[model samples]
Target: MTIPEQIEAYLTSQPQAKRTDLRALHALMLQAIPGGKLWFEDGKNSEGKVVSNPSIGYGTRTTTYADGKTKEYYQAGLSANTSGISVYILGIADKAYLAETYGKTLGKATVTGYCIKFKKLADIDVEVLEAAVKDGVGMTGEN
Candidate 1:
C-alpha cells in the first residue's frame, strides 16, 4: 500500500477523526522532511497480519554537517492512535546541544542519544529538525 493509503487506513480506524484531520497530519509529516525516501515494513506476526499493529515506515534524508561530515536520519510515520511521531538521528553524537537549542520549539518533546519524540507534527520546528538531520548525518561517519 502507498504511504497515504497506509496513513488513511490508520486514521479511519481512529475513533471519530475527520478525513481533514488525516489529510492535515499527512501533509505535516511530509512537510517536516525534505528530499527524503519513504519506506514501509509490514507489522505482521508469523501467522497473519496484526490488526492493531499495521506497519512501520518513515522518510529518510542525508546531508552534510557543519563539520564537513555526512550522515543520514529517518523520520517515521505515526500510528493513528499514537500520541506523536518520532524523529531518529540514529548516530547523533551531540544530542544534548541539539536538544537544548531546539527544545524551545519542540515543546514537551523528549530527546535522547539519537531519538526525538514529538506528540504532534506541529510541535516540531522544521528548520531545527533539518539542522538536526544534517548534524546526525555528519556525526554518523557513514558513507
Candidate 2:
C-alpha cells in the first residue's frame, strides 16, 4: 500500500475518538510542515517482527547514530499506544528543549526529549503542539 493509504488504514484502525484525534493531528502536521515527505512505518525490523507501534512520519532528517551510521528518518512522528498517543519531534540537539518550551503550555500532555504523549488531543493545546512541530521541522532544516 502507499504511504497515504497506510496512514489512512492506521487512523481507521483506531477507536472512534482516537481516530478523530489522529486525523486531526495528521492534518495539523501536513499544514504545519509544508513540503514534507509523508511516511508510515509498520514498526517492523529487518526480520519483520514488530518492535514498536506503527507510526506516521512527516518531513525528513539525516541522523547519525552512536555507531557512526547515518540514516534518513522522519523529522516528526505520530503513533497511538495502549495508554495514549505519541508525537515525536526528532533531531533536536537539546534534549530538554521540548519539555522546557512546551511542557507547561501543552496542558495534559507529557513532553520529553523528543516526544509529546497524551491520552487525548482534547487534553492538550493543539496550537502549542503545532508550534513544536514547526520548530522541529525548522530544526531539522526541512522548513
> For each candidate, what is the lDDT?
0.55, 0.92
Candidate 1 residue lDDT tens string, 15-70? 55433444564455455444455554445677886655443334654567899997
What are the models' TM-scores? 0.51, 0.95
lDDT of model 2 at position 17: 92
The most accurate candidate by TM-score is 2
> Which regions of candidate 2 are displaced past 4 Å?
66-68
TM-score of 1: 0.51
Q: Which stretches of candidate 1 lie over 4 Å from their true place?
A: 16-25, 45-58, 61-85, 119-143
Top candidate on lDDT is: 2
Name the lDDT of candidate 2: 0.92
The count of backbone overlaps in candidate 1 is 3
Q: Candidate 2 lDDT, tens digit per residue, 44-120? A: 99999999999999988888889999988899999999998999999999999999999999999888999999999
